[model samples]
Target: MLTERFRFLLNRFRDRLWVKPLAVCLLSIAVAFVAKFADGTGMAKFTPQISLDSIEALLSIMASSMLVIATFSVSSMVSAYASAANTATPRSFILVVSDDASQNALSTFVGAFIFSIVAITAVKNEYFEKAGLFILFVLTVFIFGLVVVTFVRWVDRIARLGRMGTTIEKVEHATAAALRRRLNAPNLCGVPVRSNLEGLAVYAANVGYVQYIDMAALQIWAEQSKVRVVVAALPGSFAAPNNILAYVIADSAERTDIDSTAVALAFQIGGARLFDDDPRFGLVVLSEIAGRALSPAVNDPGTAICVVGTLVRLFTLWSEPEPVGGKQAPKYDRVEVPELSARDMFDDAFTAIARDGAGVVEVAVRLQKALGALAASGNADLREAAEYHSRLAFKRSQNALSISEDLEAVAKAGNFKTKHAESVSSSDGKQQ
Candidate 1:
């Protein structure tokens, strides 16, 4: 439970551009003094003596060059982030910013710069003996090589970082991971709540979206209070001071013993939704990107079509018989979590695209085909939702498309999805 909370915090902080760089800079400063400490080992007598001037000159060059590179790295990343937010969706900004290669590149440059400055200053003050200077020189050379390699690798990535296709790919991967995690913990490893919980309500303290649910904490509280903890708002659900996050169903008529404050803390609230645990958020963001592309200003039907294909792939993941690695058995026995609704997911993924791209024949046709694939999925819930969306998209297109041929085209695709769904259901029935 603590690990999950810590992981959410870690991921949240890691996305910030400065965290890694700041950490690396501090480590570099510490490393700068490593040689001085080693000089006390009496091993200096066996080391080769090197001139301090060469080391100082090398350090000076690195110190100057690294600062420039670090600044440039930040500038480029900022531009890429802005581009991703504008071209794709603001929600995708974090994924682009959290690119491992980009962060590593920025951290390496800043770390090298800090190391050089500390080393050069110490050398000028005669802080290191001859052996220490030689050791620092070796370290400097290693750091320099690292900088060069990182720069080379980062150059390739920065070029493609914020492009529409790149951002879409990043969002798709995030969505898929979230979907997989959902598969593994459909009920947050808690018992499934089948009916309305009759209990004392624990209201959220904040006005924001539900981010993380500490199920373990809820279970602990439930055990202590001799009550059942029924989660009312899952991750991605909106939270308000007046909204109940969870209901504590206790046998006792007086529920004064239950710590309502502690129960409320289990539901982590944030200013906006996150993709880490909220698969629906990811789907919504993907739809937003497609919706933006379909806007009159962008008028990019191809991008919308691309998004349709991506959505199809993402939705199919939910139909997998088992999670990729295997699912962990439910652990929070006393805590009950509602099932993630398949209908909600379909709504998040397709509603915006169908609404915004209704007039674009190409986009509407692509959407229909994508829904068709889902309509035939083995998962009955997915098939049902897909068929629903297919009909919805077709109806919307029929209203928006003025041309007879365009309307007929979308209708044909929707008909195909319905027929295919029936055939699949019949086949399954025959096999049974």
Candidate 2:
């Protein structure tokens, strides 16, 4: 219900590189002291007497080694982040920054370093008896093993982390998740408002992107106020004071009961767009990567073509059948929510690539065929959008490429015909 705001905050928190490591640091400190309680477990008798010097020596090695390793991990990850932004898109930096492997590796390094420091200090100050020292030693060995395993695995992953392919993969995964969430709950679990609201329009308190909307909260408010709320501004939408976020459909007598502050609070407006609930933002960001690849400075048509295929894979998700019970009745029927536009998604994913790679015949051909694939989807909306974009890409290629043979290949790949395919000549010179 109030998950939208929480989800937004959680996503932002994850984007910050320090959050996970700091949490691990605190946990490490806690575990260092908590291990003292194990002194009374009578477990120390089961093992040979371990000297404090041995533990201190091991901790000293870990403390010094871990500090250096943590510094190295940070440098390597920051380089990867910079590379991803430069090679892909600046918008993709968030994805690279929040990579679980990278973050976990960093956390393990820093957490181990802090734990070593605390354990060394404990041993030096005689903070632990023999039992506690044994427990700390066992935990230290466990952490050491963890560090080795994490470092090895992370090294492999970091090798390709910032590469174009990996970045593209990350973007595709994010887009797919968002697409699935939206397709499953197209109305944001609310009934559709097909007509104009005859009630008061709710203006946003600030001007920014509507990053999230707590529809359940709004539904509760509407129920209390006895109104049918129409959500006008959805996640990924830019909201200004002049823009209407929702329409509170109520009689004049019910209007006085509405709390303006509560309504505005329901919509989480932020300076940037989020991918959690906003599938379109993902599309736009993916397109930005493709656009950057298509740019003359990069001249990486292969990446752009790869991106087109990735985009096709994403759109294909839309045609897949819903899971069991996915069609359940709207939970927030008191509130109205709008669905995403297939056409707009098409524009988001393809328009920039089409325009940017117009002159590149290979990119053009691949894009045309990509659109053709989408056009073949079972969904009529997708088919229509694909058909329109196919013709558009074909037109751009025709204008950009001077060679007749290149234009012919592009057109043939597109398999495009006139608007009235029934009456107009087809690409094969036959009317359908």
Candidate 3:
């Protein structure tokens, strides 16, 4: 029964677009006349001679005020309604957050008292003395209120459309696999590639705030390589490199395209951040190998790869292997985990990369040194296992390096080709 009632209400609201405006108009008219009547006799004791001119002036003023007030009120109401209707989450009522209930009540009381006092003063001042004018004032107020209500509703509709227009713009400019592919051609900067892929494709892309890129290119690359690509976080959202932004299937060819797209996208987005001199930009690449170990929902073969990818990336970033003598020691102590922002992690990685030039050989050498030190210090039996795991890490690092190299090659080639072509065209013009 409740469901049926709700359905009915929704249908009614949908059908009667003018219901709110009409109701506001009626309420405004009632308030204007009631206030006038109450003040004329109950509050104000003075009575004056009625005159046509006085009636006309009073009616015009009251009508104009009523119309302006009603228009603003109805506009606010319509905007609130539209916002509530379009939100994904359930709308909560406006709750008073303050704990001072007494103060709030006192304020309300004082406001009402002041309004009454003002109304009485207006009456005593003989603002509504003409009887013929009173009738005209009431009629004029009603008509103006109606006009205000209608105008307000129109404004609300326009506002809602404006909000939708912004959302559409974001989606259009959002980073997708397909978009990455289109922008992949040789350019001044280098070949574009994607980096740090993780997460399912559920949320909308946020633009301008943070990680904004063309997702269409990535999607195209994914399709060509037969990899499933999915984006997770909304655009403008602050995220760490290890944060799962999207998930990609790791079919070899698809993986290559996916990695390429991811790397390109990272460079584009991160470079943009650098250009803007925003210190919060960073990227983290997750290996799909780890994605294969999680539960089906958490690791949905198709769209859930990023969940596992994120886990792997975090593990690589923070975990320390236990001593070799211990029972396959835990990589990380739960208690020691600190809440670190993406910017912090990226900063650390950036510093490391800068010290070592971000070359594949340099990164691998560093990782090996770090791993070797841990192994020798009774941290784990990684020496024997280091070769296996290090190789995997090397592979991941190599992919990143390849993307960077490809981007550079494309950039250099494009520059050389453009310069040569320009020179040739100039020579031809000179000969002519």
lDDT score of residue 319 within candidate 1: 91
Residue-level lDDT tens digits of model 2 in 1-83: 66655776898899999999999999999988877997778877785678888898989999999999999999999899999
- Give each model a TM-score: 0.93, 0.93, 0.21
Model 1 lDDT tens row, 235-353: 99999989889888885767667767888888889898898999999899999999999999999999999998999889888899888678879899888899889999999999999
Question: Of models 1 and 2, which has the larger lDDT?
Answer: 1
- How many backbone overlaps does candidate 3 show? 44
237 in model 1: Cα distance from truth in Å?
A: 0.7
Query: Which predicted model would earn the best lDDT?
Result: 1
Cα RMSD (Å) per model?
6.0, 3.6, 22.7
lDDT per residue as tens, model 3, 175-222: 122123212221111222243444222222322333343434554555
lDDT for model 2, please: 0.85
- Candidate 3, RMSD to the unseen true structure: 22.7
- TM-score between candidate 1 and the true structure: 0.93
Candidate 3 or 2, higher TM-score: 2
